[model samples]
Target: MWHFAVFLLLIYYLINRRNSKYLLYPPGPYSLPIIGNLLSVWMGLKNHKYHHKLWQSWSKIYGNILGLRLGLINVVVVSGRDMIKEVSSREVFEGRPDGFMYTMRSFGKKLGIVFGDGRPWSNTRRVALKYLRSFGYGTRSMEVIIAEECSELVKLRASDSGQPVLVNQMFNISVINILWRVVAGRRYDLNDDRVKHLCGLVMRLFRLVDMSGGIISFMPFLRHLVPKLIGFTEMKAIHASLQTFVKETIEEHKASIDIENPRDVIDAFLIEMLSNKENAFTEEELYVVSLDMLEAGMETVANTAVFMLLYLVRDENIQRKVQKEIDDVIGIRQPSLSDRSRMVYTEAVLLETLRLSSVAAMGIPHMALEDAHLGEYLIPKGTFLLMAIHDLHNGDLWEEADTFKPERFLNEGKLVQDERLIPFGLGRRRCIGEGLAKSELFMFLTHILQKFNLRIPHGDSLPSLEPVDGLTLSANPFSVIFEQRSS
Candidate 1:
């Protein structure tokens, strides 16, 4: 009876919402009346592993923006640099797409501020940026935390007594401590069970989204009403774990409020939450907003570092270039912000790493809040524009863009920036934690390389650079030797 009812509902929706006649909706390969191009998307997506092929397949036919549907919802995939730049520039399409994955995993409506659009996102972003700067995000204080975490990581790896450790386990603990410093204001050693719990929760949340088959977007009604009817069983466990962790952290901050010297992000937010309960800061906003930084900051950073090292282990030439640049600039010592400019090739390597291995393959989806003109199409209000960062990164608008040639970023042996590759994204909805993510990647990777060279496990072949599916393109496990680098 329930299945029949859902079928009837889908049929009803197909008739009413299946109209893709809008001039602005952009044309693509056809979808079924009810499913609306989902099968087409699934067909092109390889290994359920590489979903970028879905965008690549359609983009080959439809220049930049291609529209498809995940059941009832219409999705516009922005596949080129021009389309992404244009759509992202529009304030109308500035908020995160609402769904079960975003809600349950991203801390929607619980203690985070990512769901809402328009004035609310703007206001929250403004204050949050201020708080981040206050917490010394780009300064030495932030670097100090990353350094501390790296030290703990070294100690833990060293305890393995030269045996290669499965980097996923070790790197995750290091990543969480960095988040702890950013959000909670304290650094935890590897021995801390809290660090272990943080990693566990992050992985659990990742798994929920990974297994969903885009069904959360397809069947929002099921998730909103009967979650069990859908496949988000682990979601509840993930929610409870994350919520408890966040609530406890925020409460601990409340108990130990220091008006004199605010140390961490929580302390700064606490001051704001206490002062402005009405306008800029609210109790709900503080908890959830901090939750946002915690979640977004950790996952992306960790994934990126892991990918960079994974690539470095296989592509020894690139790794050697990075190390040579680091050594030439900062010497045999640890890298510092002062060495930031001097480390030209290191900087280039980082940029190329981001470009080749974009953490968010199809970046985050942005929703149109108001109708807007985009090229030959006029996007209506409430439409979604999913930016295919993979296309933008791989496209050869720049020479030899597909290959991981770090030198492409260095003109005449000096580092430069490429506006074409917006890995952290662009415009109002750009990642707030960009600065910290960059810092963590640089510090963590350089620290590891300075001490040990990353190589594929003995007798094991180099791992493929192809990415697995999820919100981010995480490189799967490839055994490697963390052989000590010569002094």
Candidate 2:
């Protein structure tokens, strides 16, 4: 029976191959029957967490545009700055994948802005951006919220001065609090156990899945066959807890909702859902979208801030230089967006962190909306798009790419903006939280630097600059002593 099944799969693969044999697909390694490149890709990702680098090495052999097949799904890994920009900017390559693992977190369907596509995604994203802006997402008001959080974090760290702080998840609470202020119109205490629990769940979720998405994303049948082995069970539990948080928040908002005057983004979305029954907005979507914002907003900013601190602590010279810049520019005043213009070296440090870390390395996979030509190769309809953003940041494009040198981003003390370094991604699918993230990172980092000196704890070695690889790059578990600055 197994032999017969294999025979049928071989015939099926042959027929599909014959159909596309004449077309010029991007070059790639050979794929076998039925499974395609699934086994090889899975093994590579499982053994080495450097998914982007693995693809980069493959791109070297198969040109800049490398192709592969995972089961029946066609994937195109596009490398280089121009090629990534070309695919990202084009409408033909703007769709998100609909694989089970991709949508499983959002209740087994593409409901949220991150994983969603088509007109519904457009409508929801439009509404989200509008409401987010109104609730101080990109405005000075947003900076105020971030400053408040940063102040609280500084206080908390100051209280624990000279202690070995596990700084890995240190920034999570503050980052999430800022997001909550914008989204739910409420903030949690710095010591809130609930927020800490959710942070733990989110970190676990990141490790369970990645940009390559593991075997379960393509071959979902294994989820039922070996749910525990593939992390399906734990993933669902995490999503459930997170979904409950969103649902409860939505309920709270609904009880106090004033449709005439929306207080926050949730209220605004609730009003839209309530007022327009004919619209695409639904209760489930509201929950999922809220989850999306919370999950996306919390992890990236916090991780990047932690990475910045790690880099600073590892190099006293760099940290002191940044502090010197901060001292020269801001002096005693609280850090603000207005100060960002004058603090070039500090800005370069943040940029270098974003580039070197490249947390969302491969980024969310994009799907082809229609048959298209990417450079010299034909991208058939339904092809998955994976841009090598990590390579764009660390590849041959930049001199001393792996070295965490902020000076590369500076020219005569003025920050040099590089088009190749797109840590927040690009084009229409760019991160909506870019403005908020920058504000949070700037405010948190500057506030901490202004108030204290980050140092490796006494008698302890420097924290590893190498990040723990996952869906995003995170600083490995480490600690920093917040020495009170004598100014």
Best by lDDT: 2
All models: lDDT?
A: 0.72, 0.85
Model 1 clash count equals 5
Pick out the ten consecutive residues of candidate 2 with the lowest summed lDDT.
16-25
Candidate 1 stretches greater than 4 Å from native: 1-24, 46-48, 105-115, 210-213, 224-230, 259-261, 396-402
RMSD score of candidate 2 (Å): 1.8
TM-scores for every predicted model: 0.90, 0.96
Give the alpha carbon lDDT tens digit for every residue of 16-53 in model 2. 78776325788887888888887777677676557776
Task: List the lowest-lDDT window of 10 residues for candidate 1.
Answer: 204-213
Report how far off residue 418 is in candidate 1 (Å). Answer: 2.2
Q: Candidate 2 — which residues are off by over 4 angstroms?
A: 1-8, 21-23, 42-49
Going through the candidates in order, what is the number of backbone clashes in each?
5, 0
Residue-wise lDDT of candidate 1 within 290-385, one digit each (tens)?
Answer: 667666666777778877887787788888877887777777766675677878888887898898888777777777777776778767666667
